[model samples]
Target: MKRSKQWDVRGAVGFAAFFHFLYSCATGCLLPFLTLYLRHLGLTAVMTGTIMAVKHLVALAWRPLSCILARRHNKRRTVITGSLVCSAAVALTLLLFPPTGNSTENKSCNISQLNNVPTTLRPRTTLQKFSPSVRYSAEHTINPIQKHNSTEYISAVPVNISTLHNNQSTAETTTSSRSDGKNSSDVQKPSAGKRSRSLMKREQKQEKITKIQYQFLESLKVMDTQQQMFFFIMMIMILWEILAAPLTWAADDGLHEYLDFVDATERHRAVKPWKLLGAAGGIGCSGILVSVLYCLIGTVLHFYAYALLMGLAVPLAALLPLYRHKREHVPGAGVKALQLVRGDSQAMLCAITAVLTGMAGSAVSDFLLWQLQDHNATELQMGIIMAVVPLCQAAFAPLNGCLSRLLKFHGRLLPLAILGLSLQCLSYSFLQTPWTILPSQVLAGISIGALWWSLEAQSADIASPGTELAVKRVFEGLYLDLGAGLGSVAGGFVVQKFGINTLFQGTAAVLGLWCVTLAMLQWRIPRQRRINYSRLLAADASEMSESESEQDNDWLEKAMEEDKGNNNWRRLD
Candidate 1:
């Protein structure tokens, strides 16, 4: 039986690792480039931002409701499979909306022209000046005799120099004879009429050229068709997020449920390493694939790759073990969690920090690609850059244990993490080349990892008995949903109004100031008054175990009274 249980644990772990890998592969293929793809479709910055913002907002609102429905209906596996299939189908539909008009061509032209405007304008003006004479000679110099085929027209031609001189003398004699009478007006009329005709032709040709140039320039702007397409694409994205967002929460719940059933809850931490590895592999590999496809076809194949991976994961999602155990529903769990957070000043600070961190992280993730594209970074470079972040996170994850010990001793991890985030933001503002930004990603990975770790530790510390999960859920909502949603919208507006550089610089300044405030707040607390929840919880657990083994009823009552007194002391502290 022990061997059988061991085998079951191994199988569950292997299945989970593979499934997470496939799911992450699908997500990594599309999400990093989703904004870039929108911009490629000729949507303005503001429009792209709005679409992204709405996507996140819709996901945030729908995730909880979807999870609740799935749980209530006992359809966890069904929801997971259905959402993946639907998401894959909807993502594949993006291929149907090809870029309209010569927008891509015009955008490229605009960029080149903007760069060399001073040098290019001189040649264009010179060509315009010389075009009319060349056009007139080429188009209008046909022989009159050839068209008329008449003896009179043939006789007017000067076949030799002597005939040309004789014709000129005859014209001069006629002009002399008519110089004193109304016949003089007849002689000048033909010359004036010919000049007016030539001028009219040149003007017409110039108008045509000008109209063509105007049309070419206008193509760089978003057209009505593109606007309609944007709206349609935005709707599809929102729908995609609505369907796909719940998968993460549901998968987590399912994994925990399975672990509980197996009596191997300690293996929960063991699963994260696999998740990180899978995510890093997926992101890195997909990026390279995208670059290759782009080089071969001159178009992004993000959605196609996403669809293929998602389809592969759909079956695995169905196969996932999601065991349900009968348990009594706890009422007012949310209210109790809220009260716990409200009573703890440290928890409130941690919650605020989570919001800020989410905002900064979201802003960077959404717009960093925009900045890189502006620098003309290739798909491969972007892929490597993105892949490095998760890789770094995984590499540095072990250091978190050491950092936790140091933080427990020094209590400065959260503030330092905030400072690191500020520096990362500042670094982005000064980015000159895509490659130069690589090192900053290490800082980013570390800062974000530490910040989240500290927040989770703080949450665990502050949570009251029986309300641990609820408190953690509240923090997750703050960090991932509410904070992320607000960040996307705010970042979009900032980028639209002030440009990407300003957005980065301003965020850095704000975060730096916030870091200082947090440091000052931390310094104000007296050391002796601080509670060590980890030690307290450890001691409480040991005491409870000892009490359970005791046979004396009076000793049990005395222990209960002492526990109550300690709880009151904790509240006061």
Candidate 2:
């Protein structure tokens, strides 16, 4: 049955924010406690690294299995099941293996370490206190990711500063009570206990990370049929390195800058956890409140709240299209019009589309980034600029879910994407005022949001079929991951050699090419192409009665022989 556009976008914008919130929390949420977790588990650094690396390695395989499961069931069920699995993993991290040791490695003691970081607790400014400086501070660069000059790139979970600080302070008090012992000098501190605890926490956290890696792999596999998975992965590939490197590096520099600036005002900052505890037996809110006062100066820190909110929103928004499609079925003959067609060749076409589209998008984005920053940046500044990619992603990423309803290629959408990229290029090519770059950053955000979702949706349709979804999803992962790994590495090289403008131009050119390829594919396989594709399906329809007989045939045996040669290449297998 020709399904009508069963558009039931139920849920307010707030609902969309909720899911993206969880995902954002998942990113940095674990980090603050990871070392503490490692201490509890008592693992060595080598062991910890192995656990983490192994998780990524395992992720490489698990995605395919999840995709198979999804196909066997369906997209909705697969997502639900995968979500439950993710939740289970999180529970295991927090509750399943509560630190066994009651000594230095215990969870209670780790909480003590946190309590000592006074700056985090009792933040001086009111939550939601947005001042005018947040709008026009020199410290604030032009938001390269927001679609508008005013929309800053503040994506990430809202760090509950008070929650974070209080937790740490509480842990610090517990640790101090142990270290200080009521008599003040009653017993020698056991140094070995501290080392063991840190190591243990590190190991366990790493193990948990490894497991999450596998989960990501499987989700990628399971989501293959949906096509949006490719777009998601593409963003990861194109921006992970750019974002991770700069943010991580710039964070170090930015902290140093903050301390220096604070010093001029006779303001004190919180010490690293161990140092603070050594200086003071334990930090309480009363004591921490003083430190929060110092931070009242750098109020820009709180924009992270908005980032957190946006992250939570985007993923939850996705459930709308899926549920709505299920509900608004036309009466009577609608089911017959939605017949599925399946073929190995069509599956292969789907995979190719993901790779080509990803390549085009990734190349353009990275090139533009490099071109914009090449001229007057230190390596540190370059890293800071690179942070722009993820910051933008955090703000604009939610737009993808919003796009599910409009599948048809809109002429305006592509131009918007192009304009965004071109503005970024011009920012590199011309915009000298650092502040002017903010407008360009906003444009960049829009481009990323539009291109990613549109390409993913289109790719999913490359070879639509009702059967063999497992095999289809496997292809989805192969093309997507391969493109991402290649793209990130290449993007790094391009930035190193060609000046940033050349890189931007190259990326823009690739975007243009990507559109052309998609246009050609669309023209060649016009909707009537469905009727042509249906011929194989229609001819094979009678065989549906003897599905077993067809599977037992000669080609199945031939395909099995080829499977041994190259895994990603299903045709050869």
TM-scores for all candidates? 0.70, 0.34
How displaced is residue 157 in candidate 2, in Å? 38
Model 1 agreement with the true structure over 501-546: per-residue lDDT tens digits:
9989988998999899988877785432347677785674446665
Clashes of each: 0, 52
lDDT value, residue 442 of candidate 2? 57
**Clash list (residue pairs), candidate 1:** none
Give the lowest summed-lDDT range of ten residues in model 1: 150-159
The residue-level lDDT of candidate 1 at 516 comes to 93
Q: Pick the candidate with the highest lDDT.
A: 1
For the record, the alpha-carbon RMSD of candidate 1 to the native fold, in angstroms, is 18.6
RMSD per candidate (Å) reads 18.6, 24.9
List where candidate 2 sits over 4 angstroms from the true fold.
1-17, 25-61, 66-357, 360-431, 438-480, 513-573
